[model samples]
Target chain A: MTRFLLQRIGLMIPTIFFVSVIVFSLQQLLPGDPALTMAGDEASPALIAEIRAKYHLDDPLLVRYGKWVAGIAQGDLGISLRTQQTVVQLLTQKIPVTLELATLAMIIALTFGISMGILAAISRGGPMDYVARCIALFGISMPAFWLGILFILLFAVKWRILPASGYVPLTENPLENLRSMIMPATVLGLAVSGVIMRHTRSAMLQVLSNDYVRTARAKGLSETTVIFVHALRNAALPVITLGALEFGQLLSGTVLTETVFSMPGFGKLVVDAVFNRDYAVVQGAVLCTAVVFLLLNLFADLAYAAVNPRLRGR
Target chain B: MSPYVLDCIHPFARGPLPAKTGKTLLFAQQAGRIEPRTASGKATAWQSEGPPQFLLDVRDLRVTSSGGYPLVDGVSFTLNRGETLGIVGESGCGKSLTSLALMGLLPPGMSVSGQVEFEGADLLKLAPATVRDLRGDRLAMIFQDPMTSLNPTLTVGYQIAEGLIRHRGCDRREARDRSIELLRKVKLPAAERRFDEYPHQLSGGMRQRVMIAMALICQPALLIADEPTTALDVTVQAQILDLLAELKDDLGSAMIFISHDLGVVAENVDRVAVLYAGRLVEEGPTRSLFEQPQHPYTIGLMGSIPRIDTTSEWLPAIAGTLPLASDPPPGCRFEPRCPFAGDKCREESPDLAEVSAGHRAACWKAPL
Candidate 1:
């Protein structure tokens, strides 16, 4: 099992390398001049050329890519032309907020989604099942931005329940920070819950029919034990896969949600960099997102081994 | 007998037959170990003779699928105390369905109607909660396919002790000790070490032994073994069968053994019932039926049994396939397969009729 894990870890190196190459090349291909975008229309052509030279824009494409790769290897993601600050420093400032929101969203989505799924599976054809199905459908159908606006209107404007937007650092006051995050978290969580709930229900239904469940029932176990102990453990493999995928998606989804809620995070950082064509910041933010997704997938694979011993052999 | 009593006996009587006083006395004797006649002396007083301390009594059981079609139609039999009753049939012949219904563990969308009287209580009529309580306390089931019967994530000890803790109300520590005891009873070597091992860690035969230990942990009065040894090798099959017989005798629990193998049934069961397309075609003492099979299907089954004594190059097989229960042939379900099928066989469904003093067969033409 240790050897298998080591082998899987080794395989990730090449996968990440390929992903980095594709992301680097695609960013180069996009139509925009970072120096021009930073200098603006009022700037003279000679000043734009001097700024380009300072950033080594005159170098050949391969040489520039090689320099970028070397800088990344040394933990220097270069500097943003628009912000005139180190890309890594800018990212460090925003990462915690994004991470907190993503984590809370995932927790909320998984808790409610898995419970609803189990209830639906047990009740099968009852009203609870119907209601769960409808909820999931509505969750999937509504856009996160639209839902965020509605939440702000109902809870903040009309009900005076919460602030409509803005973020508070957890260190300043934990309760206020959590309160600030709740709306965006709800928007992201509801969207992801649709996928998690559907997969959990289907996987549970499949596991419930296994012969082991029948044996458990024949042993006169309570219905609770039969479903949770014998069925759910086996069923949860697919849910784990969905969870990891959704976590990766949460990082990407934060862009729209962050924009709507106006919470400063990696999502806003990427959007600001993209509009200003701050090449260094865009590269750093995209690379960070890719690395996080890759690590999360690896963690998920390891978790699969932990949850299902049978996979240890593979 | 009074009219009420006579009315009660009417369903059992048939075709201008004389009163079966001698046969009734013989049935009483074969049933065995009855206390001396009670002073009440009321007619049919023998009906409450305490069931011979038997294990399971399934009578006229009709299990229907969600589509309202009978999966197991009108099946009835008894498993005597410490004796095994083997039910043999082809695949999809409702053999496993009958066992599931007997255990009250049928899947959703299926309905069961009939008397599954375990010990003295009518299991079918009991509330589900009551049935749940009775399960694992007085009755247990060992399923086929040991590879799939055990929960993969749990250790063998936990699986075996689940029933003990649930039904017998044993604490974890006591249940753990009893589980080890059961493992030893099933003859697993190094029971203590094996108790912590998961199902995937064990061999197929060892897994099957674990399943048996789990089923027998609560010392249930009846054990429904559904093809327990089918997934095992021939040598392992014999060993498993021997172990089951030994455990059944030691525990004094009755067994309803369901299998398609005639040889295994012949070696294990005291009485045998042959099912075809969801109906019993022949039933009698195992030895009597094996020696003189009255139904053509039973004879076909006997002839098909491969033997060391025979020199024939090809063993006999019942020619046509068993009919599907949904679209069973008009009269007899076995008519399509029986070599001796006739116009009368095709025109009427034959009820189980006495072919000998103790043997009954459902066929227009008996072995004679």
Candidate 2:
């Protein structure tokens, strides 16, 4: 098991290297030159030259890449031209808000998605099954931004129960913070719940038909144990893989969700940086997102070993 | 008169039939305590007495799908304590379903009816909860495909001990010790290590042994082995069969051994029940059924077995496949495949009739 973990972690290095190369190279093709964008269109040629020299714009692409990589290795993401702050500083401020939303949304998604899925599978072809399917359809089909707007309209505009838009830090007031986060998190989680529900239902149905499940029943195990213990664990293997990928997607950012809620998050930071041609911030954010995805995948592999011994050390 | 002579006197006998005298001979051979009762004078006593008590008495047990199509129609047989009864048929002939029905493990939406009297209760008439309580406690089953029959995620020891924990309320430590003991009894090497291993870590034969250990851990009175050796290697198949027989003898558990292999059934079971298209075609002591099969279907099945002793270039396979479960002939289910099938065989279904002492066949023309 230790060997497998080490091998998987070792594989992430080249992946991060490739992501960095791609992000750095792609930032150069955004049409506007970074130095010109920083210095305003009406700026004199002298000002432009100064800005270029300050940011190493005269250096070759390879030399610039080496410098950027060296900075990253030293935990310095350089300064954002638009914000006039270190890229690391911007991330530290935005990451907490986004992490809060993502984690809350994930908890909601897993709780509703997995339980509804199990209910639907157990009472197949019954009213609960159809209800679950209908809800899944609503979740998968409705756009996140639109759903957020609907929640805002119903809960904020009409009911006047919640603030229309904005975010509060949990450290300031936990209650108020949760009140602000509920709508956006629901919007994001609802969409993911549909996917999870569908996968869980199908996987469960297949596992329930397996011979081992019948053996479990023959062992006089209660229907609960037969489904939850024997059937659900096997059914969960595929769902776990899907869940990790989904969670990774959540952690990266939800642009539509953030924009609809007017919340400051990683997606807004990354997106604004791209338009402003803030190369360092964009590269740092994308690299971090890629690293998160890789780590989540590694965790998923480890979880598979824990759940299924056959995959252990292999 | 011998029990066989009394059995032959009953015309078109259906429902519960007389006990086989061969059972006594078998008990004598196996236990060596009960003297063989082959003499006519001793058999005469059995003939005059009331029906002997049966450990399991199934009467007209039928399983029908929700659409009301009969899957297992009117199959009945009785088993004595510690006696092995082999149910043999081709695939999709309801051999497995019959066993499943007995264990109350029928697939959902399939309705089962008729009497299954075991341990002073009709199993079919009992509430599902009661049946669940009996399952894995009084009645246990070892399925055909061991690879898929065990939970791959659980340790073999945990799975084997599940019955004791669930039914007997044994604590974890006690259950674990008992499971390891059972693993040793099943002849699995390194019982303690094997108990901790998952099903995938074990070979097919080893997995089957683990399954055996799981089924026998509770010491169920009735053990249903549904094609337990069908998925094993030829040599491994023999070993598992031998192991099962030895354990069953040691445990004194009455077993309903379901198999398609005639040779295995002949060697393992005391009595043989031949099913065709969801009905019992022939039933008798294994020796008599093998040597003098009265039903044409049973004869056809026997002829289909390829023999190394024979020099015939072409093997005689049964002429046709089993009749579809949805649509069956009104008369004999085997008429289409029976070479001796006549007009009467196609007009009306034949109930089981005594062909000789201790032998019964469902055919219009018995004693053929």
Candidate 3:
């Protein structure tokens, strides 16, 4: 099992290398020149040239990429052009907020999504199943931004139950932070839950039809035990995959969610960096997101081995 | 002892015949119950007044899917205590469906009718809760494909002990101890070490043994084995069958062994019932049925069993497939495939008629 994990981890090196190359090339190819954009239209050509030279942007694309890779090896991600601060410093401040929101969202997604999925599967043709299906449909169809606005309007603007939008640091007051985070987190979580719930329900339905489930019933177990203990555990593999993937998505894709909620997260920072043409900050944020996604996928693979011992190979 | 007294004491235990004095007492009892002058009076209510020897008595059982089409039609059989009754049929012949209906484990949308009397209560009329209670306690089942039949996440011991803990109300420690005993009974090696292993950790044979152990842990009155050995190799199949036979004798549980393999059924079961497209076509003592099959389908089944003595180029094959239950032919279900099918066979459905004493067949041209 250790050997298998080592093999999988070893394989990720080339995968991440290729991913980094693609991200770097794509960012370089964008229409606006970061140096020129930072300099602004009124700036003199000499000033632009000096700024480009200072940032080593005048170098060949390949040379710049090599430098970037080398700098990454040294734990240096360069400095943001717009914020005039180190990329690492900006990320350190912003990533925690994003992580907090995503973590909360994931917890909510897994709890509600899996429960609703199991409920829907058990109920099958009942009214609760229909309601769950409709909720999932709404989650899937409605835009995240729209959902966020709807949540804020319903819970904050009209009901006055929560603050309309903001990020409260956990250290200040954990309870207040949770209350402040719940609305945006729920919106983000629900959107993700729809996908997770759909996958979980379908997977569970398939597993329930398996001969083992019949065997469990034959053992004279209660229906709950047959479904949850026997069927659900087997069904969980697909749901696990969906959940981990959604977690990675939540980490990066919270830009629109953050903007609508007015939360100060890495998503908003990345969006701000994109608008300001802060290449270093964008690079740092994108790389961090990629690493988070990669780690999540790795965690998911490990979870598979943990959950199903057959994968451990006899 | 008079046969009438024996019958009154053990109704389900009555064999094919009664002793002379027992018959005399039975006649006396009948005479006392009804007027002697009547020629035919509702066949004397078909009473067998005695404590049951058979654990399960399923009579004229009909199971229909939600579409109002019978999946198992008019199937009647009994499982004697410590004896196995094999129900053999091709796929879609309602063999598995019959077992499912018996267990009250049919999927939602399917409905079962007719009497399924387990112990003494009519199981068909039992509430869902009562049926749930009865299952695992009095009635248990094992299924095909141990790979999928055992829960992946649970330890083999836990899976085996689950039924015992649930229905038997054994505490966790007691359940675990009993589970180990069961595992040992199934001949799993190092039963203690293996107890904590999950289903996937064990080999296919071991997993199947775990399944069997789980089914037998509760010491159920009846065990319904639905193609339990189908997924195993030929050698493992024989071992599992032997193990089941031994276990049946030890536990004294009546077993309904459902399989497509006639050889397996012949080795394990006392009585054999041949089902064709949701209908029971032939039923008799296994030896008699195999030696002289009364129905054409049963003959085809026996003939199709590859024989070692005959050096024929091609073994006999039952021609055509079993008809779909939804749109079965008018008369006999097997008429389309039966070589002896005649116009009469096509026009009228044959009910199970006594071809020989205690032997029944539902074919117009019964095998001589």
Each prediction's Cα lDDT score? 0.81, 0.85, 0.80
> Local error of candidate 3 at A115, Å?
1.8
TM-score, model 2 to reference: 0.92
- Which window of 10 residues has the lowest lDDT sum in candidate 1 chain B? B8-17
Candidate 3 residue lDDT tens string, A111-177: 8888899999988989989999999888889898898888888989899999998878999999989
**Residue-wise C-alpha lDDT for candidate 2, range A10-59, written one tens digit per residue:** 89999999999999888877798888888897999999999999888899
Q: Give the true-structure RMSD of model 2.
A: 6.6
Query: What DockQ does each prediction reach against the true complex?
Result: 0.50, 0.73, 0.50
Worst ten in a row by lDDT for model 3 chain B = B37-46
**Global fold similarity of model 1 (TM-score):** 0.89
Model 3 residue A17 CA deviation in Å? 3.4
> Which numbered prediction scores highest in lDDT against the true structure?
2
Expressed as tens digits, the lDDT of each residue in A65-131 for candidate 1 is 8999999999999998877789889988999999999999999899989999998888899999999
Q: TM-score: which is higher, 2 or 3? A: 2
